[model samples]
Target chain A: MIVGERKPLEEIIESLEGAEKVLVAGCGTCVAICMAGGEKEVGMLASELKMAAKLRDMKIEVSEATAQRQCDKEYLDTLKDDVKGKDVVISMACGIGVQYMALNYEPMRVVPAVNTDFLGANLDVGEWAEYCQSCGDCVLADTGGVCPIARCSKSLLNGPCGGSADGKCEIDPETECAWQLIYDRMKALGRLEKLTEIRPPRSWKTSRDGGPRRLVREDQKA
Target chain B: MKSGSNLEKVFEKGEFALTGECGPPRGADLEVVKEKAKHLVGYVDAVNVTDNQTSIVRMSSIGASKVLIDMGLEPVMQMVCRDRNRIAMQSDIFGAYALGIRNMLCLSGDHQIFGNQQDAKNVFDIDSIQLINVVHTMREEGKILGGDDIDGKPEMFIGAAANPFGDPFDFRPIRLAKKVAAGVDFIQTQCIYNMPKFREYMKRVVDMGLHEKCHIMAGITPLKSLPMAKYMAKKVSGIDVPQEILDRMKGVEKKKRAAEGIKLAIEQIQEVKDIEGVDGVHLMAIEWEKKVPEIVEGAGLHPRPQVS
Candidate 1:
């Protein structure tokens, strides 16, 4: 799921500088799962901003709201009353959510209260590691179901670079080396030959290098 | 000669080829490059021009290679995936090949935080192996990696870096085999201060018979002083310096330690030269370019073949 963390209290407070009314909106989907900019986070941010405003002796009204998913226009449109005439609307969701709020409600400044990180899985409590690069092209089958694009520090397709040490990336020992995991996974599956297969250069068309991508589904568009 | 470059010719004739490294100046100072080239000429078969080594911004490797080419020295331009994307890298490879540069050493560049610039974005679009395959595919098939044909391609002898002492030690030779499968013609390993470990690595290479497929040049850096040895042992990753080596350096007097370091390096050069799978030695006399002639001559690798 999309991962993100809330912006610092100081930065959120500063963005609402001289603001009379502020709306803090959260998403109940991906961001919530990652424990980032979810409904609870929205309330925490709103309360912290209110406390800061009081300490600074500023006149501000902090309100909190949450949508089932902020990336959807329908979910965002339902929050019209909560965001109506608010001096600034702070999104406690991912970047996609912030953009959706701005698209529906214009001229009212929309700011992000969280820094969007990556699409990944939660390994353990308070631990998240990226698992997908959204490279558009997937090589999981050839790589024992591992995503090299997001795991390998260099995005090496063929195999690991010389930096794999103790099954961790040379850049940081804490980060697991993606290729090591791929090799071990392949070995366990008795498909080690899959690792020996040389991979050609990935195409940019399916990657972010191609530019901002948009997908349209004719079958689902009904 | 596959590349028709002097380095490839040396490797082809089965001579213990010697290569040196000449880092381009951080600014536009071609004179510094020429001076370094002067120190390496006649003593080494090729010179590796580092590309923003350690991630600090420097003169582009292609530009530095051009200077070396004009100075009658073969420039092995070192390329890394840290700075450029695929489009930019391919364009630069073609540009370098078009201008008489024929050799390259692909590397996964150091993280930017190690250098002066900590805020720079790292673009590892493809690792060194993928990079080698790109150039190799272009040369063999006369096509881009995406299967598009081009009028010309980089008919260059490609090389990559190896680290035998790095962790998951069992995976080093396997990684080299993968590089060869990706179409690497030659390899220069990370600096070697640990001989037993490197010999063990080469034995594996021989066991896998990778030496028959590609040339492997052992990397040697003559320690300048005891402090330098300590720094390399502690600060540098993937470099294994055994306790005996450090003790040997300590055994020498302060004034004579530099010469002792050189002697140890010459010993390494002589030993690795006999290692069955090892092809040659790459002398990275970093910041000590002037001493290259001495080391090469002392190691009996002087008078690089003048074969055209």
Candidate 2:
């Protein structure tokens, strides 16, 4: 899931300078699961903004509305009525959702209230860790299903560098060395020989190095 | 002789080689490199110029190598993947070769968090093994990574680092074999304070017959003080300073610790020299260049072998 965290209240408030009427929008998908930009968070942000405005002697009115998923146009269309007459739309969704909302409501400034962190999995209550980098190409099959591109601090394709000690990365004692995990997994599966093969230089073109990416499906196109 | 470098020539002649390291100054001072090279000029075959080691910004390895070359000393210029992409790496290779450098050491480099520039973005576009292959392809095939033919290839005696003390201890030898398969001509290991562990690691390397494929140089650094010994044992990653060595250092008087450190380093050199499959010793007198000659002489490795 796309994990995101709400932007600091001060920065969000500063972004709304000179706004008389504001709409605090939320998404019910990934952000909601992460407890960041769900309907409940939207209500809390709206009340806080109203209190801040009152304390500063500013004449401002804040409204709240949430969509099932802001990335989908059909779901965002439901908030059309709530968005009307608002000077600004504060999107409490991931970066993609903010951009989608801005595109759907052309000429309306849709500001992001959350910072999209990464494609990750929630390990526990309020604990999330990145799992993939969306690098168009994936090599999980060869690495015992461990994603070195995302897990390794250096994104090393070959075995662990000299920095692996006690199964921890040299960078931090808390972070587990990704290659060590791969080694352990491969050894458990009796596939240790697979690691002997040297991986060639990665074609970073498939990654962000190739620039902004787009997926085109001719079969699904109208 | 691969690159006809003095180091390669020494190895080709089946002579035990000796290399030294010289870290460029934090500022742009060629004099510092020359001063460091003076201590190692006649005492070693080739000098390794570190590239922003520990991620702290310093004069580039290539720039410092050119300084050594100007002083009539051969330099094994070190290149790290942490700072440059393929294009920049290749460009520097060409430039370094043009300036008379013939030896190169490829490394993944220390993380930037360990350096002064904690906020800097690292460019590990290629790891050390891939970097070794890149240099090999550029030299052997006369083609850049993109498959474009170059007018003149950088004929370098390529080298890579090995850390026998790194974790998943059983896999350390396998990593060395992978480097050998990647076309590395020589291997300089991380500093060895744990002789028993290093001997076991070498036994595995010898069993795999990787020793026949590339020259293996044991890394040696003198512990300047008890504090320095403790730092390496605890703080520095991948470096294993055995408890016995620390206890030995602790037994020495504070004023005599430096002497004890050099004596221990000399003892290590003598033991490593007798180890089968060990090719040489890379003396890294980090910031203590003046003591290199004494350490080399104390180890009975003085009057280095001469090879044309």
Quote each prediction's TM-score: 0.94, 0.98
Evaluated at residue B231, the lDDT of candidate 2 is 92
Which tens-of-lDDT digit does each residue in B261-297 have in candidate 2?
A: 9999999999999999999999999999989999999
Q: Write the per-residue lDDT of candidate 1 for residues B222-260, one digit (tens) a residue.
A: 999999999988777667788889999999899999999
After superposition, candidate 2 runs with Cα above 4 Å error = none
DockQ: which candidate is best? 2
Give the TM-score of chain A, superposed on the true chain A, for all candidates in the order listed. Answer: 0.97, 0.98
DockQ for candidate 2, C-alpha atoms? 0.84
Which residue pairs show collisions in model 1?
Answer: none
CAPRI-style grade of the A/B interface in model 2: high
Each predicted complex: what DockQ?
0.51, 0.84
| Worst 10-residue lDDT window, candidate 1 chain B | B165-174
Question: Which whole-number lDDT from 0 to 100 does residue B228 have in model 2?
Answer: 95
lDDT of 1 at B161: 93
